[model samples]
Target: MLAAQRRDLLLARLRQDQRVVAKDVAAELDVSEDTIRRDLRDLAAAGLCQRVYGGALPASPAVADYPTRRGVGVASKQRVAAAAAALIQPGTTVVVDGGTTALAVIQVLPTTLAATVVTHSPTVAAALAQHPAVEVYLLGGRLFKHSVVTCGAAAVEAAQAVNADVFLLGVTGVHPDAGLTTGDADEAAMKRALARRSADTYVLASAEKIGAASRFTVLPITAVAGIVTDAPADDDTVRRLTEADIPIIHA
Candidate 1:
């Protein structure tokens, strides 16, 4: 096929699957892997995809701002949040990440339950103000506006001090091969630090994040205790994670 035709077809596959492997696309199009690579590079230059080592991911994931993210996949996030909330018990000290989904976890938490909540997001800390039994600790640091969370040395040091029972982690992507990832380096560092301080870490992932990848690696998928998501066990991404013996809680 012509270069333009092949590129269009590749874009369509990426739209449907959210990713396109170069070798797979080459075979499907009856073309060479070099041709597929060129097509992907062109697509990336056109701002349609983000080129990865062996594939390309939809560009939206690479630059999804906080507000846009808060509005996408609402129901899926709610289900994930519900499952994550159930993991928390009374008197548990939880390290809640700052994000819309994490906020949903705060909303679903029983008011009667007492817990210590540590976080770097001022917004998350404020949301817990109405919880009469919860103690809130807001980590001080340089604020990162994209996700509206704190980062840098102060945040990392503060996270080290908190002895949390569990960390309700959020991420931009989760892949069996790529592990847990986020869009920014500082946020990844802060998340890693928090995970180290917690006894157990559970990632709250929406279906969109499953099988996806991002620029910065937060932690290996095995580093986390488990994943709480709404994806079915039969799904390809979920199956891969399960095969790796990574526990998945389907909501």
Candidate 2:
């Protein structure tokens, strides 16, 4: 098959099976594995797919800019947000991560619920301004515009001082094999730092993020308390996550 044909078939397989194994596709196409690997490399460079150890996985749309992502997964984000927001109890402290899904969470939190929220995102902190009962703690640092979250040594240092009952984490991708991932190195580091400070961390995974892969891994799938997602329960990704014993909280 031609290289263009390979790209189309590879992407199709990624959509259907959630991943494309290089050898498997090579055998099916009667082509050499090197050729398939080259195709995967080109696709990855174009941002059309995320290359993994063996082959490729679907690229997450969540890697887009903050404003663009706001319109990408609206309903699914709301579902997962509501589910994650439900985990916070009154008088408890929670760390809310930065992302569109995390932003949606602010809309679901009860205005009367008294709680403390620690965050590295100025966006999240500003949204909580109207909440009369909740106290917001903003972690200061260099702003990472892509996700609109604070990062760098200052943010990681601030995270160490926090002790939260729960952390509503967000990532660009949630896969059984690829684990939890995001697009930026600093954002991933910031996420890991916050997870350490919180007793439990639950990922806010909307439908679009499921089965996708990003450039940098934030944490292993098992590191999280549970995955809160609106993706179909029977989805191959979801099924594999269940098989791996990662808690799946259906939104």
Candidate 3:
């Protein structure tokens, strides 16, 4: 088959199965493994798939820009946010990540719930301004406008002083193999810094993130205490996570 036809087949398989193994596709198409790998490489370069060892996984749609993400998964974000909001204890401090889902958590939190929140997202910090009892600390740094979060050496340094009870993390994708991932490398580093300062970190994963992969990995699934998601129990990603004994906090 032509390279274009082979790539089309790879995309079809990806949409159907959420992943494509190079060897399996090669054998099925009666082509060399190198040919299949080349097709996969082109697909990855085109932002259609995330290349992994011997295969590729579906890329996430959640990597869209800040304003665009506001509309991507509204209801699912509410569900996951509600569950994540419940994880913050009454008097404990929490480090909240930046994203639409994290902003949803701020909305779901009770007005009178007393707590401390440290965040790098100006949007998240502003949303918490109306909270009667919660103390908000906005980390200062060069703003990464893609996700509307602050990141750089300055934000990383500020995060070092934070010793929080928990960290609510947001990422672009949550695949069993690719682990926790985001679209930007520096944003991924900032997330890791915050996770390190908190006693426990819980990922805010709406249904859309499951089964997807991104360019930069933030952390492995095992690094987190649990993942808070509204994705169905029978979802392929959820099923894979379950089989691996990963603790999932369902919304």
Candidate 4:
């Protein structure tokens, strides 16, 4: 087949499967792996897909700006939020990450609950203003406008002084093989720093994040305490996570 025909077929496969392995696509197309690689490279350049280690994912899965994401997965995020908020026991210090999902967790937190909540998101800090019993500490750093979170030396340094009972992490993608990933490198570093200071860390993800991969990896799947998602236990991504022995909490 012509190069154009091959590329078109590959895109179709990517749309259907959300991912396409180089070796598998090459075999199906009866083409050399080199040819498939070139097609993938061209597609990535055109912003049609994203190139990963052994395959390609449909565009970038790192997510859009905060407002856009807040509207993307409302129900799933709310479910995940409720489940995450349940993990926070009264009087314990908790580190909350920034994201719509993380904000949702803050929203669902019990009004009567008493705890110390530390976060890098100004939005999260403001949300806790009405919670009389909750102590709020906002980590300071250079503001990242896209996600509306703080990152940089100041944020990482501040995280060092915090020792929390639990860290509620929010990410753009979660995959058993790719691990937990986000859109920005600095944000990933900040998250790693928080995870190190926490007794346990749990990822809050919607179904769209499952099986997806992003630009920067925060932690390996094993490093996290467990995953809380809206995807069913029987979903393919959940099965993959379970097979890896990572705990899955269906929200």
Task: Return whichever of 2 and 4 wins on TM-score.
Answer: 2
The alpha-carbon lDDT assigned to residue 54 of candidate 4 equals 83
CA RMSD of all predictions: 2.2, 0.9, 1.4, 1.9
Q: Give the clash count for each candidate.
A: 0, 0, 0, 0
Sort the candidates on TM-score, descending order: 2, 3, 4, 1
TM-score for model 2? 0.98
TM-score of each: 0.91, 0.98, 0.95, 0.93
lDDT for each residue of candidate 1 in 1-251, tens digit (9 for 90 to 100): 88888888888887667678999888887888998998888988776776788989765353477888888889999999899999989889999998888988988888898889999888889989999999999999999999999999988988777899999999988877678888889999999999999999999898878877777889999999999999778777798889889999988
Write down the worst ten-residue block by lDDT for model 2: 1-10
For lDDT, candidate 1 versus 4, the one ahead is 4
Worst 10 residues of 1 by lDDT: 57-66
Residue-level lDDT of model 2, residues 1-251, one tens digit each, is 77898899998999999899999999999999999999999998988899988898999988999989989979999999889889999999999999889989998899899999999889899999999999999999999988899999999998889999999999999988889999999999999999999999999999999999999999999998999999898999999999888999999
Alpha-carbon deviation at 18 in model 3, angstroms: 2.4
Candidate 3, residue 62: lDDT: 94
**Model 1: lDDT to the true structure:** 0.86
Please list all clashing residue pairs in model 1, or write none if there are none: none
Candidate 2 ranges beyond 4 A from true positions:
none
Q: List where candidate 1 sits over 4 angstroms from the true fold.
A: 12-19, 27-32, 45-48, 57-63
Ranking of models by lDDT: 3, 2, 4, 1
**Cα lDDT, all candidates:** 0.86, 0.93, 0.94, 0.88
